[model samples]
Target: MISRMLVKMIAVLWVGIAAGWLNPAVSYSEEASEKVLKLHSGLYYTIQKGDTLWDLSERFFDSPWVWPDLWQKNSQITNPHRLYPGEQIRLFSREETQTMVVESRPEPEVAVEPQEPPYYFYPPINSVGFIKERPVRPSGAIFKVKGNKAMISYGDLVYIRPIGRPTFTPGDRFTIYRVLEPLKDGEIKADVGIQHCILGLVEITEGHPKFAMGRIVQSRQTIELNDLLMPYEARSPKITLTQSKKRLEGKIIASEGHERIFGDQAVVFIDKGRQDGVRVGQSYYIYEQEKERLDSKKKEDLLLSPVDYGDILILHTEETTATALITRAEKTVRPGARIRSPF
Candidate 1:
């Protein structure tokens, strides 16, 4: 009897070893297989001003046509054309896994439904022209005021009054402009009175052919009737096109104090506009005019050396002027600084 029991015990031990039930390494491997798996497979993007779904899709997915699907899946955006800046987008994996457990309870009957195979569709490989269906105007247009004497104080009620034949309706948005002095011979001269300050934004509360009323939501100073207002219109700012694009030059017409939120904001009246191929969201470097330096050893010796002051990010564009936000500043940027496209 003892011999027979020993033989049975040995057989049971061998079976456990062969099945990997008695080995810690085998047990660990199985445990690892059962655990959930994750992957770093997503992109995080921060939306910038004037960025469109089509532009973003073209940048990331290699196709702008796929923008509609991405917008539908990722955002609560009803209109694919409109996208706000400062919004965050995260793309994550969709795969998931579940584990099964056994118990003594009676099994319940379950029904299984057949699933159809997914259809595959490929987007076109060619680059498609991105044209606006309607010309994009400034958000607040008809209610803008125009004049050099508009006194804009902080916390003042601002409005955009339409002038001449009305091109905008009620509830339409427009942009406001502070009148700036003209550039002379590719040089911008800073005159205290000519430097226009952004008072605030206004919305059209009422509309008419000759004028419109708007409520001011923001202002750097108190707004008065003397301040000139330009209503936001969708039309591209006017520009004069030259035969040679390489010979074009950038001009700064006005300068404002540094913004607490945007760091610094500068008003540039470029010779180029929509007609000249100047588009919104274009970036330019602000180069301070080369200081005229004289050698101490020889008073007659003069040197023209260019200094880089900062960079400007274009925000709004008009036929005559473009508003830009300063991104990097080594020193205060003055009027007449040269702005060039980045290489």
Candidate 2:
């Protein structure tokens, strides 16, 4: 029997991290490689509702990056991208399984929308989360505001240093984030990262990379001086819940506002991140671990299985932390609760 259930990682994470996988020792001529169809076989998993081949790859091989690779190996599957419940999936082994001729599928056309660092909207903005890890120092900051204004908001003149000729162009846009305090895992102060809070966004109005000025195109919160400015790229991802290919245990480290107790539509933070095989858009059930109160005498305390507090949609991820928005909650969830893959 399989020891436990599994969770999933992202399918679109293949550009880097090749060093961690095995390299083929045998080399074949171009003609020989083209003629043969590569096939791999290993233990099989019975698919359940909402199971995807990418999820299977993550479970058997700890990689969601190779669903297409797995697709080429199976004679039974026409499209690895599509899957159904109660089907047996053969997961190929690396040492013995190799393939030629990968069946291709029509690449789905995706619409690119203007993205925030990573924000979401499904039933409105209920929660906003953050991560505490080694933060990347921004390339620029809001050094001074024009007109000596106390604060700046959407559409304001601002002067930046260094001038744009060397480092930035006049049309380039940047994500605005205010660096918050460092959050610790427990009590340790040495292990810390600046809590980067997404403030809004800015478009370079004039100048160069060394010194540039821009207008606040949008603002979710108050824009202030010294706010960190990072080169912006559209990262807002469409999120949905799916089965996890692995059983990952993570903790709720903080609430959106660091509140002790929070209810429906609140944003929260978790300890899991990209380095831990967590991907943005994957959902996990938030749970609370508790010990059952004794009744008639077993002499020792018994801990109950974790109770489901709610579910959360991961919005963004860092190396060691992730920002998630709460979809549902009961009992006013708090930090220190555990989160595991949705079975």
Candidate 3:
């Protein structure tokens, strides 16, 4: 009977061991560890309401400007301007996972207004040039063109390299331009800054840390090899007509194309700008002074009253210079023409 009891006890112990193996209890620590591993492996995050790429970039990268980099990394974003809630954004990864899903929508094409506004609108005036006190230091340059072409135009792909080894990423835009000889004051013959003629607009499509590929989206002039690049700034098409509040006087230093004589609708550069209380949409009168007959008796010349011949509308302004469009010209306008407040 004792031998029977021993065999029965051994069988009971075997059954208990099998039960434990079949149904093991999971520890709290093991479950927590599994969750952490899953999070690290994917680094996926869900978009919440009122969340923006700018806010997210600042939260993760400590800078709001880093939003563009974040946007470029996520290939799923069709419109960088809008984001939908419940979309998953990958926080980190060189290779995006297949499970990642996002809303697919076609980006709307930006329509370029071919007609120039007669009075109140300026179509993409940023493509118009500006004057600086000094030559613009280039941020980058077009190094090569795809298909081994000599000239680049709209939709042409090219390679660009950043100067000073600064980092540039895809989706970044730059204004392509070329420098002409230094502009000079028509009266004093003083040297102004070099003229920057806008060639085109280029958007970086893909790139390395130092160099990248870009495509020309708009061409105002012929884009050539080694064309300089600078940060692109958006121009507003709507302009309001405003009367000048200050009695400011300045001279027309130059005109677009360096033309000596131009008329209505011509782009001209003046020596007065923001520092002198000049502003966009302000109107100024172009005039020339006549000599009086009192100077005929004496060898000395006597100045007569000023004669107004044209009207100019300010389009853009620099620190000490401005770009103006000739709104009306009774007589042909030329460099060295005097511009002053209408009052």
Cα lDDT listed for each candidate: 0.44, 0.61, 0.71
Of candidate 3, the 10-residue stretch with the lowest lDDT total is 21-30
Alpha carbon deviation, residue 94, candidate 2 (Å)? 55
| Cα deviation of 70, candidate 1, in Å | 21
Off by over 4 Å in 2: 1-129, 162-166, 187-192, 208-210, 240-242, 293-298
Highest-TM-score candidate = 3
Residue 161 local lDDT, model 3: 83
lDDT of 3 by residue, 1-343 (tens): 3344334334433443564521011121233222221121234345666778897765544467868767655534545677776554555321222122122224577798586544566554766788888878888999999998877876678999888764566777888999988888767778877778888777788878768898776566788898999888877656777768467898888888888789988888999988899999899999999876664667876788888999888988898899988889998877889998998
- Please identify model 1 stretches exceeding 4 Å from their true place: 1-162, 165-198, 201-221, 226-251, 257-277, 288-307, 318-321
1 or 2, which is superior by TM-score?
2
Off by over 4 Å in 3: 1-119, 294-296
**Model 1 over residues 149-266: C-alpha lDDT tens digits?**
3564322234444443445555554444444342243343322222344444455556655556654433434555645554543322212221223333585544444222222433
Distance (Å) between predicted and true CA of 210, model 1?
Answer: 9.0
